[model samples]
Target: MPEWMRSFGRAEDGAVTVDWVVLTAAVVSLGMLAGVAIWGKTGGAAKGIADYIGTQGVDTTPM
Candidate 1:
């Protein structure tokens, strides 16, 4: 029933900080999820490029 206690309960000075922290965490989690989703495809594409390069014949001659 104290005024100070009521004010403390109603204080919202840190609300923005909390919101920023939550939003940053959400963004980082989403980025990680996207990276994980693309991880396998990226590796496969890189390997395919490597295989294609390996299969190509290289001619070494002087001009």
Candidate 2:
């Protein structure tokens, strides 16, 4: 109803800040997703290696 309130409502100065915030959040989310994928695969590979070694046994044991 007030002129000042209407002007404030139409302001564009903070729009860029909002866009940057949203973009930053999206980028961080993608990075986290990639990190989780890599971490999960690495863990699985390590577990597989351990299982193989356990089943095959070490070729030699040190003195």
TM-score of each: 0.76, 0.72
lDDT of 2 by residue, 1-63 (tens): 999999999999889999999999999999999999999999999999998888985658688
Error of 2 at 26 (Å): 0.3
Candidate 1, position 1, lDDT? 97
Point to the candidate with the largest TM-score: 1
Q: Candidate 2 clashing pairs?
A: none
Tens digits of lDDT, candidate 1, 1-63: 999999999999999999999999999999999999899789999999999999999889877
Model 2 residue 33 CA deviation (Å) reads 1.0
lDDT of 2: 0.95
